[model samples]
Target: MTAPLLEPPGGRPLRIGSRTSLLATVQARHVAELIHEYAPGVATEIVPIRVSADVWDGDLSRIGGKGAFSKEIDRALVAGEIDVAVHCMKDVPGDVPLAEGTAFGAYLERGDVHDVVVTRDGTPLADLPPGSVVGTGSVRRRAQLGMYRPDLRTERIRGNVDSRLARLNEDGSGYAALILARVGLDRIGETAQPQEVLPLEFHQADEGVVSMVPAVGAGVIGVQARQRDLAVMSLLGGLNHDQTARHILAERSMLHELRGHCNSPIAGYATTTADGAMSLHGMVFNRDGSELVRFHCSGSPDDPAALGSEVAAELLRLGARRLIDATGG
Candidate 1:
């Protein structure tokens, strides 16, 4: 049996590497607190590192969107600079990359995987004033928003959650509303106060789900100590959230089959139901969501990755490949 250890390496203060942003720190601290609670003797610490990705000089295209943020932390892990690296699962890419013979280990309880829209005055998106400005950097979000409000103006806004929130003004000068992910708001404890919390089903990324796209091999975050460092892995095993792993597998598999990147207008999400089966919702769009094509896969659900692959295959057959190739996705 793959029995997990009750406690991590004791007496040694384990360092958890993470970005310095408020959201990143909060997530890192949460994991640290859990470890301290589980193993009283095991000390914990947090290391803040700066990545070039966060220094947005107005051009998000060159700074390397999501992967740029994770590659540095992953390097630190490889060098054993930290016992483990804490990360937002969505920021990671689809594949896991480590020196050959190495592998990613575990993940945390997933946050709201869906995306949400934040409009002014707690009003539903439909109620937003005509010509409302919705801000987001995700091609998926923009495409979906365009589908709903053909007249609405969508702009690219980047920065930490708070940074983006700062741009939402009391005066109407700023964008009427900002489009943000629900999980991020919840993590920073700002879920309720932020303007209109657009329902996700219609908004694409809603409350209760996170649109995950982890850097290759970054989906898992339990720990990556060497084989000789079994103690660290043992301690991290206790922190593992099995359902989180399943969701990562299902979501990442869709990206893998589709072979998408920042440019690719491909999107996918996986959900675990009461019956313990998985449901996958996927879509591929052109520059505009008007040409959007979506489909869902349902089956034993135990084979989430397989189900995701099957869906990608179907999309490719349905001309998704031609769409991507033609659009430079």
Candidate 2:
């Protein structure tokens, strides 16, 4: 028989696994708050787990790529160290499967789903001069920047959001602009910086200058727990935002169908209409943005995964896989 959802448990507070970074801690704390709100008196603790991506101090692609960030937390979950784990959904890989007995149980409400361009002096993308160095580690961003302004050179950047912004805010011969996630900025409360935050739809140099289809599950926080953990699952299920989960699942399914890595230069976004239909926009680009493929599909929100897979299939039929492979993502 299943245990009651709110049967006063033992003295141990439910432990939550999360990364140690400031932004990660903030997200984890938010989840903890939600759990407390949903089940008053259900104690919870935050457990910080170190990850390979945080310690590799080198190229992630050459190491383990996106999985490096969440693998440790997942391990904690599998090892019985943490009752639940919070994740920046984008860090969860599409190609790498999850550990046995573990799965995402809920998705917190979504946040801003667009990447913002931050410039040293709030200069619009078009105003930037040729040969300007833009710092970013994302292949998609690099390719999109090339597509917009081929003359601007790109330098690989790796660090937490704050560190990246600090480097750009400092006076140096470093990047003139940095491409960062707007959601992250808001979470960290660093939106008041002197840099300009350009809208995803902002046009300057050319049509679709900075395409922002968004990474799959970009602004969502996922709560993960052992599938059979009835108590944890029940508690988190109360916090799940059905609409956000549907959108993320659709995006994730589209990514999975392409056999693309989570860190691949692929971008996809899904939105639900008032009438309960889901529409997905997906894009695939070669390493240099020399080639581009874009597609869209709509379906009932009740079957987001199917809609996502269908869109991905259409994209692949049009040679999306070829473009994805060329990037080595």
Best by TM-score: 2
Residue 290 displacement in candidate 1 (angstroms): 1.6
Clashes of 2: 0
lDDT for each candidate structure: 0.66, 0.82
- Please, what's the RMSD in Å of model 1? 4.5
lDDT of 2 by residue, 14-110 (tens): 8989999889999999998987777777778899998888766566777778988988888899999988999999888888888899888899999
Looking at model 2, residue 319 earns an lDDT score of 91
Measured on C-alpha atoms, candidate 2 has an lDDT of 0.82
| Residue 138 CA displacement from its true place in model 1, Å | 1.2
**C-alpha TM-scores of all predictions:** 0.84, 0.94
Q: Which regions in candidate 1 have their CA more than 4 angstroms from the true location?
A: 1-12, 57-59, 95-102, 170-173, 199-228, 326-329
Write down the worst ten-residue block by lDDT for model 2.
1-10
Which regions of candidate 2 are displaced past 4 Å? 1-10, 195-205
